[model samples]
Target: MGSTMFIELHAFSAGSHIRGTHIEASLIGLKRHALTNRYKMQTSINCARNSDKSYHEQHKVANLILPYPIEREEFCLCVFTTKHHISQHPQRGDRRSVLNDSQPDKNHKHRHLYFDEATITVSGGQGGDGEAWQTSKTKTVKNFKYKWGTNSQKFIELPAAEPADGGRGGNVYIRVDRACDSLLHIHKRKFWRAKKGYHGSSAPHSTPGRERPRLALTQEDLYISVPAGTVVRRKRSGELIADLTSHGMAILVAEGGAGGIAARPSQQMYSRRQKKEKEVSDVGLEISPRVTTSGEPGEVVTLQLLMRVVADIGIVGLPNAGKSSILKAITRATPDIASYPFTTLMPNLGVIHCERIVSEKLIDIDHETCALPVIADLPGLIKGAHKGRGLGRAFLRHLRRTRAMLIVVDASGQDPVSDYTTIREELRLYNPEYILRPHILALNKIDFEWAALRVQEIKAEVQSLEESAVGPAPIAVLPVSAVSGSGMDILISELMEAMRLCDEELSIVRGSAMDSRDKSDSI
Candidate 1:
C-alpha cells in the first residue's frame, strides 16, 4: 500500500485476509492494475513454423500480462519502447513494410517490422516522514515573593516533529511464472516505482497528528510482484549480473531515499518544550530489458523451457543412438519415434515399474528418497561441445542438475574410443567436478551381431588410454541392446552400484564441509 490509508481485505489462495491501516492516498493512486495488455509487438524468432517464406505483414495482437502492484506469488515488470503499437495502419500488399518508407527510414522504421527500443525501469517508494508535535502547554500565573500568588506565567515550547520519511520505494522484482498465465504483464508498464516519501514538518508548535506526516515530507512504501521462476538480473555489466538465476527470485532495482528532518517549531521555549525533528529523502527507479532489433518481419519470441523430470534412471545417448526407443520401452515416456536426429529438444522423464522382487526394492527406494537417483536420458553431445558447439552448453547445464550420468554409447562401435572421449571431454569442460561422480557406460545396440567385436575394440582402446593417462582409470563399459533387452539385468545392477558409490562420496564431502564450517564458527 502507498501513502493513502485504508483497510484492505484480501483473499489469498484458500482464505480471505483483511488488514486495516491508514495509508497515504497518493501512494494508492500510484498503484496500477497488474495485468498485461496484448499489443502486436515484433517477436524474436524470424522464421515461421514449417514455412521458409518470410513475412513483412502485420499480425493480430496476442495477449500479454501487465506489470504492477507486485506482491508475493506475483511478478511485475516495466518495459520501454521507442514506438507505440500501430493499431490504425491500413492493409498492405504481399510485401508490406512496417516503416513509413515513403520518406527516408526514420529511427523507428525496420523492413517488415517496426523497430523499437524498450527498457524496464524500477524504483521504490520513499519512507514515511515521522510526525512531531507539541507535548506541553503554556500556563499563565502571577505571583509575588511576599504577597499571595497573583498567577505565574509559564511558557512551554514544543517543537513540531517532521513527518516520517515516506516508506522506501518498493523493490524491483522478476519472478518465474509457474502458475502465471502470461508474461504480457511484464511488457505492459515502462517503469515501476514505489510510493513517494512524506514531507517533514517545518514548525514545532504543530498539534499532535497521525503517526504519518500530517504535513508533507515522507513517501509511502510500494512493492513489485513477480511470478515464481522469473530470473532477475542487473542491466549493468558486472558481477551484479551473476545474481539472477537460481529459482523464483528478485533483486533490489531501486531503494527509496531517507526522510528529511523537520524544523523546530517557533514557540515559547521557556518551560517544558518538545524537541527533535523529522527527515526525509527521495529514491529513483530504473529497470530495462535488452532487446535486439532487426530489418526482417516480426520476431517470434520463444521461451525455451528447461525442466528436470525425475525418474529412476536417465536414458542418454547420441542422436539415433536408440535412447528414445529405450525410454519408450522401459517407461511410459512416449518420445517421438523419429529416424532423424534432435527430435527431442527437451528432456523427458518416465517411471519404470519392475515386476520382479528386486524391481520392487528399487521402486520403494526411489519413491521414498526425496533425492532419488533419476535415470536421465541426456541429449546427445557433439564433438567440441566442451568449447560450446551445437546445443552443447545448454545440454550440459541440464545434466549438471542430475545426480549422476549414464553414458549410453553405440556398441556397434564405429569409433567407440572417439565417442567416449568426446563425451568425457564435454562433461569435464561443463563441470570438472562431475568427473568425481560415479558413472557407467552402456554399450547400446548389442543386438547387432558385430557388437561383440565392437566391445572388444572399445576395451582395447580404453586400456591403452588408461595406460597413457595421468588421471584415474576409466569406468567399465557394458554392452546391451534396447531392441532385444539383452543384458539389461546386468546393466541395471551396475547402475545401482555406481549410484551407491556416488551417494557415499557425496556424504563424506558434505560432512567434511559442515565440520569445517562448524570449526570456523567456533573460533
Candidate 2:
C-alpha cells in the first residue's frame, strides 16, 4: 500500500496572523520531506474556519469533519466549518436574517384551550327618569279704572311642566348549557354590563313621560353556559348561589333596580280669593311644580364560578388495577388501556341506563326505567395521596361530589389485602367523612389463576378489619372479571339499590322540613 499521511486542522479565528502561522509550519514540513523522499509526493490541504470569540462564548461548537474523502491520488483539498457557529457568520450579521434562513415560518398562535375557574363582575342596567306636567287658568284686569258700571275680567292660560319617570333597570342572569365543556369562553372576559333604560322627557307642553319600558324582561338576559357540574358563589362571602348539575339550568344572580316613581300633577286646590292674593304678592308668573323622580340603579355583584365533575358513582383504584376496564365493560366509555402504571392521566365519564322490571306474580305493572346514573373513572391513587403524593389530592377531590364509590383492586397482584388497605387509608386520611359514603369493593381480574385464592384471603382480612371498626357498616366485596364480563349484572344491581336508598333518605328529610314550616305558619 502507498504511504498515507493524516493531518488535523483547528482554527481559532479567521485573522491573517493565524493563517500565516499554519502556512509557515506546513512549508517547513514540506521542505524536510523533500530532502528524504525521492518518489513523487501528493499534497493535501485542509482548512477549518471559526467565527469570532464573542460568538463562540455564547455557544460552544465541536469540530466536525466530512465523512467522504476529497479526491484520491491527485492533489486534494478539503474545507470544514463549525455547524453551530455558522449562524453567526460575519457576512450575515442581521440576527433576523439567520432565523429566516434556518427554518420555514409556521403561522402559529396560542389559544385558550380550557378554563375551570374564573372571577367576574356583573352589573344590572340603570333605571330611567320620570317626568310630569300640569295646566292652570288665571284672570287679569287690563285697566284699573272701571269702563262703565262693571269692570272687565280677562282670562289667561298658564301651563306648568314636570319631569317624566325613568325606565326599569335590566337584571343579570347566568344560565347553564350542556354545549360548553370548559370555561375558556369566559376566561377572556372580566366584566359584564346590561343596557341602561332611556331617560324621561321634560317639557312644558308634554304629557307625563311615558313609563320607561322594562328592559330586563323585554330583552334577553345574560346567559353564561358552563359544563354540567358548575357551581356559582359570591366572591366576597363564598356563599353557594347555584349548583348547575343539569342542562338548561338557569339562575338570577342579580336583580334589576325598579323604575323611579312617575311625576303626578299637584292636587292642592286654590280658591279665587287666595289665587288673587298670591298673584298680587308674587308677579304674574306661575311657579313650576317639581314632580319628576330619578330611576334606581341596578345591582352590582362579583361572582366566582368553580367546575367539578358530576357523577353518581366514582371508580378509584391503584394503577393498572382494572378500573378503566370495569368502566369500559359497564358503560360505553373507552379509556386507554395498557399493562402499565399511570396509564390514565385524567378522569373519564360514562352513563348507565337500566330498566326496573316488575314481577308478574306480585302485580301487573309496566317496566319503569330509572334515571341514568353517571360514572366517573378517576386516576389511580397511591400511598400518601392526601399529602399530595402522585397527584392524589387532585384525584380525591373528584369523589367529593359522587353519591357513591366503587373501589377496584387487583386480585392477581402480589398482595391484594395490602393494596386494599393502602387505598382505604389514603382516602380516610384525605377526608374522614368520605369513608361513610356508600361504596362497593370490586376485586377485579378473577380470570387469573392466582386471583381465586387471593380473593378469599382478602375477604377474610376485610371482615376482620370491619369488626374492629366503630363507624358505618362494612362495605360489600364482590369478585368480578372485567375481561370475561362475569358478576357484572350483580354489581350493577347493587349499585342501583344503593343509589335508590340514598334518594329515599333525601326525600324524607325534605318532607320533614316542609312539614315543620307549615306547622310554624299555622301557629
By summed lDDT, which 10 consecutive residues of candidate 1 come out lowest? 291-300
lDDT value, candidate 2, whole model? 0.61
Each candidate: RMSD: 16.9, 22.9
Please provide TM-scores, in order, for all candidate models, with all chains considered together: 0.50, 0.56
- The candidate maximizing TM-score is 2
What TM-score quantifies how close candidate 1 is to the native fold?
A: 0.50
Please, what are the lDDT tens digits per residue for candidate 1 over residues 1-523? 2232222211112111111111122122213212221211322212112121222122211112111112334422222121212111122211111221122221112221111112355655544443333322343333334343545334344443432222232333344434442233433343555655543332233354533333342344344444322333444432232222334454545666544232223332211022211111123322111111111111111121122333344555677777766666555567776767766655655554344414535433443453334455655677766676765665565555555556777778577777766676667767786555556677788888888667777777766765222123445677778778776666655666666676788899999999999999999
- Report, for every candidate in turn, its global Cα lDDT versus the true structure: 0.44, 0.61
**lDDT of each residue in 450-511, candidate 2, tens digit only:** 89767778888876776224235445789999999887877776777677777887899999
Model 2: which ten-residue window has the lowest total lDDT? 104-113
- Name the regions of candidate 2 deviating beyond 4 angstroms: 1-116, 126-166, 180-184, 198-219, 245-248, 256-297, 336-346, 353-369, 467-475, 503-523
